[model samples]
Target: MLSLFPQILFLAPLALTLLRVVLAIYLAYIAWYLLSRHAEIEHAELPIIGHARHGILWLSAISISAIAALLFIGAWTQVVAIFATVISLKQLVFYKRLKEILPFPPSTCILLLCISLTLIVSGAGGFAFDLPL
Candidate 1:
């Protein structure tokens, strides 16, 4: 088992990324639930930092896009992973602030969490691209 540890560590992020996708699907379903139940998710939400949530969402999109570009360029995975983790922390802040202002459904919370996690994992691409392709 100890010998398997290294292999497990190597594969961990990819597996985690796949799990994140599954969790995101579940969370999206919950978002759908909130909509169906006529909860706050259905209403217009409050502003964040004197601006709309769309700004945070845009930042999230850009963050993910940056991670993707780094992966495509075969950059250092650990370095990128660090950046992704930092961005995930920011995402957590956004989620917390959004929840305080608008009370998003549990599913939406899960989805955001999953997305942040997946980005962090995906950003660690094969210990920073082993193939040199």
Candidate 2:
């Protein structure tokens, strides 16, 4: 295929950086939502973490927050992306029930999964702590 905008090809890194940031923000939103809902419910079953206790829910929320921070800063991006991928995959596989709990559409879960996989394959991109060796 012929190049439509070859001059802007160098900006690929920035695009990946944007993707990473966006994914980080979404993850943070999920964490916040989880925590807010966790307050209302004493116990609720969660995908990949069934029969959730109060402490488990809090731990999950904290873990998700940590992942979001790590992703936003682009530290250990591939590893973080791997964890994100797993979480999203779990959500996607259990989309029917997850939607009711998370209030996010299945499409959003699919998008999150795709973005996480992309980050895993592409690394942290520009302005990130991780540099390809």
TM-scores for candidates 1 onward, in order: 0.37, 0.88
State which candidate has the highest lDDT.
2
Off by over 4 Å in 1: 1-49, 52-60, 72-74, 100-133
Off by over 4 Å in 2: 39-43, 46-50
- Residue-level lDDT of model 1, residues 2-68, one tens digit each, is 7746756777656644544443344344334334434333343534454335444455445556554
Full-model lDDT, candidate 1: 0.47
Whole-model lDDT, candidate 2? 0.84
Candidate 2 C-alpha lDDT tens digits along 33-115 = 87788755445566455667778778888999999999999899999999999888877787776556764787998899999
